[model samples]
Every structure is written in structure tokens, then in C-alpha cells.
Target: MRAHHLALLFLAACGSDKDPFAGGADAPPREDGGVIGDGSTTVDAAPRMCAAKPSRVVVLGDSITACSVIGGPNTADCVSKKVADYVMAQHGATAYQNHAVGGAKLSGIAAQLNAIQPAPGPALVILYIGGNDLSPFIFQSDQQAMQGYQMIEPMLVSVYAAVFAKLKNTTTFPDGAVLLTNTQYSPFDDCTASPYNLSATKTGLLHKFNNKVKSIADAQGADAIVVDQHPAYLGHGHHYNVTMCPHYAAGQTPWMQDTIHANVAGNVGLAAVMNGGVDRLYRDCIQ
Candidate 1:
């Protein structure tokens, strides 16, 4: 949440191999390139049977996935749980893990990835990040600010590429995996109550970021899928009105907690979009 926390996370990532959750240097090798067990070198004599479809789903991100409301207690209504429920219903996936921490940035992804246990079959890894990175530039107007954002864009792409490379090299998902990343939707853009008045610039930057995400995913091939959340949230409303907080009209509830995080309704909507994306990807896999 703070700069100090980010610094610590980055320092930990520098030695990601040491992370206990990750397959560290001491992790037992898979018998036949299969899943690694918990610190046990003894391999199962028989090959473990894998499911017909992906049986596991892991979510990694910041507050959106963490879903701790500012005033409310942490609830199961968050996006990660919703997504897990959707996947379980649609794909029969029984195992789900959420590694999302509030206020996390792309720099924190390595530790999150390290926390995942390798799956024998293909798994769905949902990654929703970068919103916090864009937060610092939400209100900048100067040319210098524009230049700074421009510089950060490529760096974000490079970070994502590096994470993907690690997943490919270290994790053993024999049937193949789907790395689903998302473009953030601005809840503060056009909101009358928001302090940051640079809606147009902010929106433009979000689109630019989204475009880069798409480009990077394409470069990563079919294994990477970018779930575009920008359009889905935009279709619901243009201005985010916090005063009309938790705006509920005709069964439509507000999708944001403050200016950035999503509320219960918002998480459900996001899960729906994610569900659609996963459905499409799964269909392609079977085909």
C-alpha cells in the first residue's frame, strides 16, 4: 500500500527463487515432468491422472482481486471468488487460489507467481494489475508528465513479458495454460465527485495501456488472453458518482468502492466478463 511496501516486495522478487511458495531450489523434481509435491522428493510410482479440462484457477492482482472494502469487512463477494465460482461451474475446476494483495503493483507479481504450486494439467491464471502504476499520473498535466507516462508504458510491457517468460519456463502445465490479463477501467473518470479532473487524459492513458496489453498478449501467442474490462464497465456508466455511492438503479449497482476499487456488483460484473473470456478460451482449447 505504501512506497516502503512496494520496495520490500521488489527486493523479495529479486530473489524469487527463495520464496517458499515457489518451486525453490530445494523443491522436489517432478517424476516425469509432472507436478511437484510439497518438499517431498519421493515421487508417486504411478502417474497422477489429470482432468479433461483445467482443474485449477489462480488469481493475482491488487485490491480488485483482494476486494477488501474500505468500510466493510472482507467478503467472499470479491472478484476472485466470483471468478473461481464461474470457472468451477463452467469448466469443473475444483481448485482455486487467490494471491491478490491490496495495493499491489506489477513489480509484486513475481512473489505472487512464486506462491503458486505447479499443476499437472493446464491452469487458468488471472492477472489484474497496473492500476496502481497509473494512479501516480492520474492528475498530471504537464508535458514532462506525459513524457514520464510514455516512458513507463514500455517498462510495464517489459515487466509483463518477463513474468510470462518465468511462467513458461518454471511452471509445468503440460496441457498448456491461459494467462489472462486485464486492462483497468477508470471509476474516477468523468465522476463529478472525484478530485482528479483530468478525465480525458486519464481515459486516453488507460486506452493506451490497454492497447499495449493487447499487443503483448498477442506477442505471447494463444496462451495469453487479455480480458478487456474497460468497455464492459464503460457500457454500464460514464461518470462514477460516489455521492450516489453504491449507485443502485433498476437492479444495476455501482461497480466501484471509491474511485478505483470495485464494489460487490462491480466484482460480479467483472467476473461475468472474465467468465466469457475463459469460456471462449476453453472452447478454443477443445477445438
Candidate 2:
């Protein structure tokens, strides 16, 4: 790790909270007095059956999805694992597989995806790569950053296209599958600070990259959805103030373990977002 990254890691501390995935008749109600809604909602017009519900969940990405944190990483504490567990519990999935590797880039994810073979039943593939691919641009000059993004842009499109195609192939998902892709979040939240002073240019490129993801997902049709982690995590970074972003309340504690990796609580929030995406898919009755 770089000196600045190490310093940020040293500053990080982990915190705990009640499991957000717990639900059902025995589940506790929310502090707000509303019954906590599990991914399985009971509202009318909500489709009770979804063919997209996976028999297994597969994860792909770098350290974030791998649950790497400031301290030693825990596979069970990461977002992907949490989401996988939720799927198994709520959707009757029998298994979960995670192929994520710490520090893996897009190319690494491509390899991981390619290695996966056709399996019985529908599977949900949760992809959360590309953050590492964009991390170095944060420290680059404006010209260099722009140049780097330009070079990576086409690769992003091509790689994602190939990945989605294979994911939807009948041989890969014999029964069927859902692709739940993620957008990267900013740990600095547009507020530049000491050590990895995030720049507007870097942030812009981040959105651009996410937009490319959104577009690709959109083109992939209803079975593919983009879990917009960026906006969902807006107020949980270094500038964890509602005043920083209109998306959430101000003055929230940072959910990050370091400059990039999310802490345990942050992973819970991410899992919630992932679950919510599936909830919507269930609502829409996506097969």
C-alpha cells in the first residue's frame, strides 16, 4: 500500500450494528416504528414469485467485494457474502460462491467470470469491480487522469459487454440468471482532504464510468440491474455530512474502513442496496 493509503488505513476503526438482513414475524420493528421490510415485501401488486430468484449467488470483484479492510479482511463480513446469505435465506437458494480476489482489476474480474462454468438452476451474479482500476487516477494530474480514463473507457465497455453476454448465455445459466452489477462509491464524497485529496476531475470520471455501467446494464434488458452504490453511499464517506450531498441526512459517521474499503457497517448498507435491487426485481416479476 502507498504511504497515504497506509495512513488512512491506520485511521480507520470498525464498528458494529444490528443485522439489517434479519426479518419476518420475529424480526424487530424499525426505530421509526415501521416494520422492517425484508427483501420479501408483502405489498399488494407485488409478485410473490420470481423466476430470477437464484438457486445460487456468485460474486466477482476486487477487495471491496472480497471484504478486505484496514485490519485483516473477513470474507463473511463483506457485502457480497451478506447478500449471498440473504438470498439463500429469503429466496431458497442452496449455495453461494465468491470468486473475488483482493486488488483484482476489471481484467481480473473478466478472468474470474470466464472461469465459472454452467451450473444447474438460476444464479445471480453480483459484480463489484473497477474501483481499483480508477483509484490511481485520483492521484494523477488532470491531463493524465483524463487520458487514463479515455484509455480505460473502451476496455470497460468491451469487457462488460463480453461478461454480460456470457452471463446470460444458456450454457452458463442453464435455467436462467440475473446480473446485479454495482456502481462505485466515492469515499471522499467530493470533499477533498489531506491524504488522497480527491479531485473534481477524478469524481467526474467516476460518474462517467458509472454512467457507462448504467448504460450497459440498461442495454442488457430487465434481467440485468445496476445497483447504484454511489448515490446510496453518498453521506457515508470522509465528508459524512448530509450537507455534502442531498441524498441522505447530514453528520453521519463514515462507513469506510479506509480511503476505499467499506467497514462492516458499510458492507451492511451495501448488502441492503443489493437486496433492494432484488426486491424490485421480485416486484416486477422478472423471470
How would you encode candidate 2's per-residue C-alpha lDDT over 203-259 as one tens digit per residue?
665665655666566555445766777666777876675464434464576787765
Q: TM-score each candidate.
A: 0.71, 0.76
Model 1: worst 10 consecutive residues (lDDT sum):
4-13
Estimate candidate 2's RMSD in Å. 11.1
lDDT of each residue in 1-287, candidate 1, tens digit only: 42211111111011112221233234454332121111122122223222246678888887777765632223568777877877788788888888888777778877887787776766888887766665554344444446555555555666776667655754555555667777656554333233444334444545555555555654554556566665566534434434442331344445665545666677777777776566655542334
Alpha-carbon runs more than 4 Å astray in model 1: 1-52, 70-74, 170-175, 189-196, 235-252, 284-286
Candidate 1: C-alpha lDDT = 0.56
